[model samples]
Structures are given as C-alpha cells and as structure tokens.
Target: MKTLKIGNTTVDTVLEWSGNLFDVGAFWPGRSWDAVEAERDWMEPHFIAPKDKSKPGVLAASIHTYVIRTPRHTILVDTCNGNHKTRKTIPPFNNLNTDYMEKMAALGVKPEEVDYVMCTHLHLDHVGWNTKLENGRWVPTFPKARYIFAKTEYDHWFANMNGHAMDGSFEDSVLPVVEAGRADLVENDFAIDDSIWLEPAPGHTPGSVCINLVSGGGSALFTGDCFHHPIQIANPDWSTQFCSDLAGSATARRKIIDKICDTDTYILAAHFMDPTAGRIVRNKDRWKLKI
Candidate 1:
C-alpha cells in the first residue's frame, strides 16, 4: 500500500494485483516498440518488464483502487476487479478470487464505512467491485455508500446491457448496485465537495472522466485510463486498443498532459505500477513522469 497526504485528507492505495499483463503490440496497436524501447533505461523493472525470451513486448500494469479519506468522507476511486465475478470475454479477469475486501479492511475501511464509490467509467475492470456475490444474487458491496457514475457512461452501458462488451460486468457488478438503489448517475463535472470533483475526459469511453483533488495546498489527479502507462507521456498520440474512439482518446490525453505538465499536481493513474504517483514533466520536446 502507498499513502499520501493531501491537505487534511489521506490517500491510500489498495492494490488487487500488478504485473506485466498486456502485450505491447496488442495494447497499443500499430505502435512501434522502437519508441518504447528507447526509454528502457528508466522503464525497466516497473513500467516495462525486463525483456525475457518468452514474454517479449509485455507491458507492466496494475489493478487497484485509491481510498481517499477526507475530513468528512471516506471515498473510493475506481474499484478494481472484484472477487467471484464471471468475466468470460476477458479471461484474465474471469472468476477473480482476490482478497480485495480484506485489503480495504486492512486500511481501516470496512464496506459500510465508505461514503462514496466513484467510477471513472463503466469498463469491466473499473466497475467490477461495485457489487459482490451474496446468496446467489449480486448485491451492492458497499451497502451504505452511494456509487457515483457519469450519466452518459451509465446510459451508454444501460442501453447496451444485453451482450455488452464489458463481459457481463454491467449486469453482475454495475446493475446490481443500481437495482439496489445505491447508485447516483451524475454529469461528468459532478463534484463531491470543494476538494474533489470529476473532470470531463472522454474518448476512451464516451463519458470517461478524471477525478481532481485539491486541498490543504496540495493537489492530485486520479486519472482513470487517460494515460494507461507513462509511455503515453512520451507519445501522447498512443491510444489503447480498448479505447472507443482512438482520436478522441489521444486528444483527451494530450489535453490532460498539457493541463498538468510542469505543475505541482501529482498524477495517480489507475494502471500505473508501484510508486504510482508522480508529476508530469516536459523532457526536451516530449513529456515524462517525474516520480
């Protein structure tokens, strides 16, 4: 777990899993490995796995949640893949049995203690922990918490609920929370308080968003998939294969980089590996993360 203090609030990372999970070629189609290889000096052992004969072009990634404890609220940003969910389309996330809840408990936060559950989007991995299996029925995992979702995002998934690309996550993890009356579908610019709010960052998904936190002279951005890896900092045009609109995703990514580059804001990207927090910096003509 990694902890950071922002103003009077506390942020803790609850990691479910991390590893070299995706093939670079597939993750970023048509992108040349030469560009990524050029940065091997700094990426080795973390962002990009050390080259191995069998697993060439693999990219390191993680699935985790950020627990933000403000003066009055215990908020969770982006719940990772939950345990016992059936994700047939994405084999890696299928029937996961992680100790994610125990990890949260270890952080002194029980399910009922959470004040809000904020999802950046409705992707399979991003919203999987919204609910859990209970008595042969899916139920809201955080019974007392109000799950926040972008209205556009929810509507997109709700309309495509049948055979959606999320591998049944909408029905299993998301719909259950809505049916249980624990969901709050809000606009992309919704704000929880003065210290935290959602910023519109579409492209990966029509309603994708990035949560902003500004408090106590400290600030941070919980970027959901805007930049999956630091490599995107160097190559801002690279959009992941999962992006719904390639051009729009790249545009949003560049806009975000331009907004935070050379600034004090720490970026806590959802898929970044350990030492997951850093600031955006300009390197010569491109951008990079200064951790």
Candidate 2:
C-alpha cells in the first residue's frame, strides 16, 4: 500500500487481490523459459506463481484501483474486477467473491463520494466494478460518479457486442453504466482538470489510454494494460499475446518508455504486483522498473 502526492492531489491504491494466474512462458508468448527463469530471484513470491498442476509456472498479478484525491474531486482510475461477474473465459475471475467495496471504504471513499470513474480501456478486469448487482438489476456502483470512457474504445466494443474482447463485460458492466446515463465518452486526450488528463496510447486495445496526473511539481502516469508486467518495462517490444495489434502495441510501449524512462515520472502499472508503481531507468542500452 503506497501513496504519493502530486501537488495538491494524492494518489493511493486499494487492492482487491494479488496472485499468480498465468504461466510465464505462455503469458508472454514467444518468450523463452530461460529468460523468465533468469529473473526468478527478483520475481518470486510476488510476481511468480508457485508450481501447481493447473499452471505449473506463471506470473501472478495484482488487481486493484487507484484513488486520486484532488482538491475538488475524488476520481478512481481502472476499477478492478467486481464480485459476481460472469467471466467464463477465465474461471478464477468469474463470479468473484471479493470484498472490494469494503476495501474501498477502508480508503475513506464511499461509492457515492466518487466524482468520476475512469477506465483506461474497458476490459473485463478494468471495468467490472463500473456496475454492481443490486436486487437482480445491474446498476452503477458509484452513483454520483461519471464513468469516463474513451469514445473510440466504447464504440468498437459496443458495435461488436459479441466479440471475444467484450467477453460479456459490455453487457454486464459497461452497458449498464451507459444505460444509467452515467457514462462520459470522451476523446483520447481528454482532460479532467488542470492537473489530470488522459493520453492516447492505443494498441493493446483500440481505445486504450493512460491517465496522467501532475499537481504542484509531482507527476505520475497511470498506464493501463500498456505494460502489464515489469518485465515488459525491460523489453518494450515484447507485446503480450492479448494485444490486438502486436506491432502497434510495441511501438506505443517503446514510445512511452522513451518518454518516461530516466525521469521522475512514476509508471503506475495496472496489473503489476505489489508496490505496483515505480519509475523506469536506463539499464545499459535497455530499461528496467525501479519500484
């Protein structure tokens, strides 16, 4: 649980769950087991999965949300998977039973106090908390908050409602927010305030974006799925199999790495394990995450 202040705004994390779920070799397709094994000492316990029958060797991840408290508003970045969501494609994420709200409350943030909910992309894990089940009906969890969604990202998934990418999330979590008239579809570079804004970093998904926070003199970048594991920070061209456009994802990742590496900007990864936020640095001719 780390917190940082950017000028007048403070950013904190409320974790839902953290553990390994995917095999390391398979999670990053084309990656060699040797490369993964070499990083064992650094990845173990937090990022690496213990050997098991289901997935013998995999990389675990943290599922959580960032609470951004500005002087005038409270904003949340990327709601983690919610309880009772039907995600059959990934059984572990399906019908989850985590005390997400309790954790949110522990942060002194009631759902009603949230002014905006921003999702870097509408993936199952990222948008599941947008709505919750109540009395047999799905409704916006943060009733007072306007859910900010990139128009390009929403349109693509809404049009292909049944696409695997949607994976029933559009119908269950996202559509309900829109139907409830709480969705604020905006452009990729939309700004929420003088110190907060969205930056286009499409590739992993059509509308994928990053939330930027700059207050006082501090700066941080809440990168969505643009870089899942810190390993990707060392190898910007290593696009995950889940990326819709491999080349585009690599290009975008490289560009971001170049922009933030060796700077004060903190890279707030969406699925990174504990101590998820850190800065990138130059490692010889490559890069590394210094958490």
Question: TM-scores for all candidates?
Answer: 0.96, 0.94
**Cα deviation of 69, candidate 1, in Å:** 0.5
User: Highest TM-score, which number?
Assistant: 1
TM-score of 1: 0.96
Clashes per model (N, Cα, C within 3 A): 0, 5
- Please report how far candidate 1 places residue 86 from its true position, in Å: 1.1
Cα lDDT tens digits, model 2, 1-291, are: 577777888888988877766565777787876665655555554555443522455677888899999999999999888889888887778889898898889889999999999999988889889999999989999999999999999998988776654678889899999999999999999998888899999999888998889988889999999998877777788778778888888888898898898899988989888877788888777677876
Against the hidden true structure, what lDDT does model 2 obtain?
0.85
Write down the lDDT of every candidate, Cα atoms only: 0.88, 0.85
Clashing pairs in 1: none
Put down candidate 1 lDDT per residue, 1-291, tens digits, no spaces.
468988999999999878777677888998877888887766666677667732567777899999999999999999888899887877788898998888899999999989999999889889888888889998989999999999999998888774434888888888889889999999999999899999999999899999999999999999899888999988989998888899999999898898899999999999998888889998888888888
Q: In candidate 1, which residue ranges exceed 4 Å CA deviation? A: 51-54, 162-165
